[model samples]
Target: MTDRPERDALRPRLSGGLTVEVIETSALGDRSYVASDGEVAVVVDPQRDIDRVLAAAGRLGGRIGLVLETHVHNDYVSGGLELSRLTGADYGVSAKDDPPFPHRALDDGDIIDVSPRLRIRAVATPGHTFHHLSYVLEGSEGPVGVFTGGSLLYGTTGRTDLLGEHHSEELARHQHTSVRKLGDLLPDGAHIWPTHGFGSFCSASPAEGDASTIGEQKSANPAFTLAEHEFVEQTLAGLDAYPAYYAHMGVRNIAGPEPLDLRAPTHADPEELRRRLDGGEWVVDLRSRKAFVKSHLAGTVSLGLDGPMVTWLGWMIDWGAPLTLLGETADEVAEAQRELARIGIDRLAAAATGTPDELAADRAQLTSIPVATFTDLAAAFDSGGSGGGGGSATDGELPAPDVVLDVRTRSEFGDSHVRSAVHVPLYEVTQRAGEVPHGTVWVHCGSGYRAAAAASLLARAGRDVVLIDDSFDNAAEAGVPLES
Candidate 1:
């Protein structure tokens, strides 16, 4: 049973007939309530934290009859169906073509009373995703607000480049129409509620500022201000490459997610770790960059073992490679497993006891590389020389290898790099390894995790490999050259 916060605790009621409540449910999702004459509640989008939404339902003291999703989300797994299961609410989605959820499909003009107090009217907004919809919430005074989803932000709009199958032209066309429609139909006082705010890559603009009125959005939003064609082209220009896991998220949301039980955490022993490693597994060190730099297992990359560990790991690490965790402690290992399972990256073969123990147990498998300081990495790249992939020794030291193989994301790789290094991101490394000439190759990434994994794979393939041991800071301080 979950403890329900006081109804008043959710949020102080706004002036209009509808009272607004915001529940800070999870790092990725949130829940809202608008209590009025009909006792209605509209759940915007939910993440893993289902209990909070349930509690909000309890606080409302009536049935939660409606759910509105702005667009298909990618950052955090959507628990839309689960919310429906817990509360017998009707799900309303904007996507007409791909109605993945079991709920009723909504289009341009559909309006429904989510609860006695809250009424939602759908407005088609397609720039973020082809079938994306925004909701106009009506209260006693009038249309009280708009749940923008990814479409119209305070000063900007959602990216049109995400869904590749849906032609940009179609999305852009719908987006233009939606923006115009929203500006025309919505009252200036309509509240603008957006899904992705700070820390989200979904929108081009930063999620900073108090909630704005429709009038403010019309004057400020670039898409709303521009003519249709220009708005479409400008929106496409700044979109960063979508994270690789986005494809998986799309399918999972459509088919309903396999229920997750976060109680059990996964970990592995050295021998088991070695076995998985031999079988093309990735060793992820779930310690902070600071903790990892102190001394972690030689080959493990440092992706913190906290919430969203698995999501970001999947985004950053090569998914094809199964994972072995090197956590800070027994608890950390379990935490890593649970978090990873949220996104279904459950390939943890075993938990490592510690770095020294693993290395001591398997001497033959332990290969060490001279770690570089952050300074070294930056200076080398700045000087038009190779960075991590071990550079040639300038003085009496051994020369850095001929080629540097960096397998981080394009964004990460582009931020800084060693000169002349061929970039084959870790996810694509194994398949593209054959293209990487056999030589004394050195591997390095933000922390050591990916580089170590790549090096291990290469060495196993009868190729000479080395790794950089220093963490991000020490590398920069050590004058490690940076490309960008």
Candidate 2:
């Protein structure tokens, strides 16, 4: 039972002349890595933070010799290609089936000799994705461990509900075949490392324990215990609603991926940014509401500049439509560009020109407003304030036909809720808001962070919104009736 905190330390062990590293990608999609050899390292499927991987390789004083992806990830953007270009590593993915993207495809029997003792064998495993593969590290002692990717988890395996147009029947069949193959090929004692854990939507039962043995997984994994038909039913049952943005990636990957140049986007200019926006480009400002409210280009939407940029943006932005950036600074603009690249969002026409004011000379092209602080928001809610700059609702008043939008997780919402409140989690608010009756909107989360996101999303979409501003603890303490 290797704990996650220990595995995340990026300590590489010596096997023959090779050094191996294991890094963990946190809930927000940030990753850290390990480097073993002085000039050679292997990078696993990187989350959005490429700097962490690069910094790890730089500290080891070795170039990244190989880039590996265990599967086609759905929960977060895969930064495999970006790190490969940055570290000069050869990218590797399974060659058994044609992947959505191009790479130095490897087969089931393929082996890469990074060093004398460190050879990685690509094992074709097809449950999570038809092309998903796991890499087994053959050390002198025996097979040390395998980067199982989404095929297997700490307690569960990856779900097959993500196969949009692809036949779920065929995909489920492949998944069943894949895990059985993995169970046979991998030694019972072999170490198992997977990408997701608790809080991930990809697996309902992501293990709290980080790495487990193949023997342990066989004993514990629910998917492995079922027959093919039963396994398919179990895998598809009760999957959370996938973000709307996921339906487009398969086609994008089938086309060869174009490398992104971090220097500056070619299409970024004042007129071009406007043209793209006029052309229906979705302007995503990767800055805080404070920064955004201080000044932002007209017709821009704010989603902030961190974690799951690709995942959330993919959910929000249309792929063929153009995009523009409102970053913190010039450096952040570059970070945003790289973040978009992982999801194949390459249609950037230009960046925000000069300053918000300089670009707003036309006046129609600019909009700025005062942002309410959380404290102020809380106060307004206490006094039954409507917060639309209109007037306050009287004490004990529900803003006539007011709809309380619970932005907490479904499980959290199921646990309890305000009276007559509609439940649409922050994740699904963007897609499901059409169902919200045109009336006052009051949003709340376990805390206020997610509620703020929900409110802002509704506000940008031209909905009248307010914040409940209740902490989970306080909401319960106030003796509010919980549904369950």
Candidate 3:
């Protein structure tokens, strides 16, 4: 369970009569806010886990009169529909997205006075998404802050290419104007409350810091300083591929996603796990790469419980597929469960925690994948003795060669990468593995995080593999071919 903090513990204090508390999702570094004036409260851009939002509203000593969303989110499932249904609050989302459920279709410049103490204005900021809105919270002193869903972030705007490349430039240009419009419209003192930041793929680049203020952003943000054309070009150039699951989130939000269920998953025994594994279910192994490589179930894929776990789960796993997990500890399994819930992936069939020996009651032989450092890999490649291949099959037999797979993004691969390395970015590897050829696949990312995930996927598919478990910088240091 997410540590549900008391609303008062958050110390809800801003310039306005509003008492605000930000419920942050650490996995994605996104935030959901409850801004209230003693009488009524409004929830902005909540994650699918509505329990936290409900608790915050109850603490405010007011009824939840409105559940507001700035835009149809791309990163995770939104809690707006479920929150509105439970609280009997008016659901407000941008009309341009054309939501299927009953809602108050919010538009640009629409002011909402929730109570005598609370007021908000919806500003159309169409950079991140074509229908995005930034809600300006009006106070006695003037505008206090704006809930910027994906538009104006702390130091940069949200990414524009998530929708598709065809619309990226157009949205990037709009984002430029949107920031300028915000700068011109809001007071310099307005606080900036953006939902996406802190290493989220939704951001164009680093936020520099999490602090939010109109004055600080105007001086520091690239969108505020660059010319429209320059900003568009720069923003487009900076983007990398976001999670493939993002393509499904916006549509689901519009259609109204099901509420999150945080119930603990059923524990399956070794025999049941083997059945699922044999059935080709995505039996994910959530142990560390070192542990996974040392010994693991033959057909289970490994994706450790670290570094953007939610994004990778969404990107790599087929939607609605039967899912089970094996973790090093119960705590690790619980953490993975919560992360999966954020993306509406709660249909976990079963989960367990055990070692290869403990998990294999049948004494089925556990398999191991080899690991390599960049220094040794470079020498072997140069000597024309590529890496190892031909592993003893545990499930089925397949002939696999030594193929170097660069799991880095296209842009990263373009900037610098190993020569002759086939790039099938980490997110695309599960579905596009056929392009990898029948060989011992050597996988490497900018860092080893993605490479670990890729190597496990290859191993699960019965492909012989070795993980390049080192920094990409080492590739250059070890005299790997330099490409521009």
Q: Give lDDT per model, in order.
A: 0.62, 0.63, 0.81
TM-score of each: 0.74, 0.73, 0.88
Per-residue lDDT over 318-370 for candidate 1, one digit per residue giving the tens place of the 0 to 100 score: 65566677765677776565456545565565566565445334665554434
Per-residue error at 69 for model 3, in Å? 0.3
Alpha carbon lDDT of residue 428, candidate 2?
A: 75
Rank candidates by lDDT, best first.
3, 2, 1
The residue-by-residue lDDT of candidate 2 on 355-446, one tens digit each, is 66665536677765333333433444455443233335533343422555787766666767765568887767767889886667767777
Evaluate residue 446 in candidate 2 and report its C-alpha lDDT on the 0 to 100 scale. 74
lDDT of 1: 0.62
lDDT of 2: 0.63
Model 3, 1-484: lDDT tens per residue?
Answer: 3333544545448766678778888677688888887679989998887887888778777789988898888888898999999999988888787777989999999988887778889999998989999998877666888888888888888998877899999999989999889899988888888888767889998777756788888888999888888898899878887787887887788888986776778999998988988888988888778888889888887787766677787888888888998987888888888888878787899999889888875766488887777776666655564434343322222222267789988888888877777889888887888888767777889888889888888777777788888999888888766677
Each prediction's RMSD over C-alphas, in Å, is 5.5, 5.9, 4.4
Ranking by TM-score: 3, 1, 2
Residue clash pairs of candidate 3: 400-439, 401-439, 401-440
